[model samples]
Target: MAQREAFAGIMLENENMTIAPGAAEDDRLDYFVHKDGLTFAGTHLIIDLWGGEGLNDADLIETTLRRAIDVAGATLLHFHIHAFEPDGLSGVAVLAESHISFHSWPERDYMALDIFMCGKTDPYKAIPILREAFKPETLQLNEIKRGIVS
Candidate 1:
């Protein structure tokens, strides 16, 4: 069985594995990006989809997220989703660069999303894919360059 660790109401489950001496592992500095004389940790995008379709469809949402992740050049580590009691859902895709997460309210035809990526990954590339898949009537987007260094 895998081991579970808990902190602040959040739990992380990990599989049992042994490391080889010569194995390549734990490299994160390579994930940072440098652009236009500035170095930053990642690009974070806040997206809101109002009056959208298929927000309640878990399979379509997952497929769309996978397609967006692939198109954005981000490596997906794991993906998980949960459906609510009535008509809502939430999901997260943990990626090598960062993560893409969202919560949907099907009754309201709305969705909130956060897409963040680091290193050589382009988070903006996911926008079009998401827009096409969700088909929102009103879309709002904002961007932040996280961990900037002068």
Candidate 2:
């Protein structure tokens, strides 16, 4: 009997593996399924927020991040926030699975966020919390899957 599997862009046939045509070598193992056969390592969300409100308050930022963590069903280990000079905020929520972080420029009404979570956590669930907290006029989001393939 022969078995085949496709991981990222590479094809595994029995004991032989080959990269799919036009697939970059570096992209070969960007995503893969775990041994349990039901989960990947994690999901990474890169978000750009524009014309948002409350981007300067460090307290609000921390609270919102906590809410996001809860909404995503992730476990929080610790979190920290810094209020920038004049008007801005930066923070990170460290989770057992991974982390959620952001940098905000209140003067420009812009914010950038990275939310990465692994091990059964659904990072996409945090989007609604972010929308309610920031109320951004424009939102740009990108999702990437990260893991190892064997």
Q: Highest lDDT among the candidates is held by which one?
A: 1
lDDT of 2: 0.80
TM-scores of the candidates are 0.82, 0.72
lDDT of each: 0.88, 0.80
The CA lDDT at 149 in model 2 is: 44
Model 1 C-alpha lDDT per residue in residues 1-150, reported as the tens digit of each score = 132222333433558333323214565256777988888888899999999989999999999999999999999999999999888999999998989999999888899999999988888889899889999999999999898876
Candidate 2: regions farther than 4 A off: 1-39, 148-150
Distance (Å) between predicted and true CA of 112, model 1? Answer: 0.4
Residue lDDT tens for model 2, 1-150:
122333444544665344554445664443333544545667789999999888887877788889889988889988888777887878888887789999999889999999998766778888999899989999999987766443
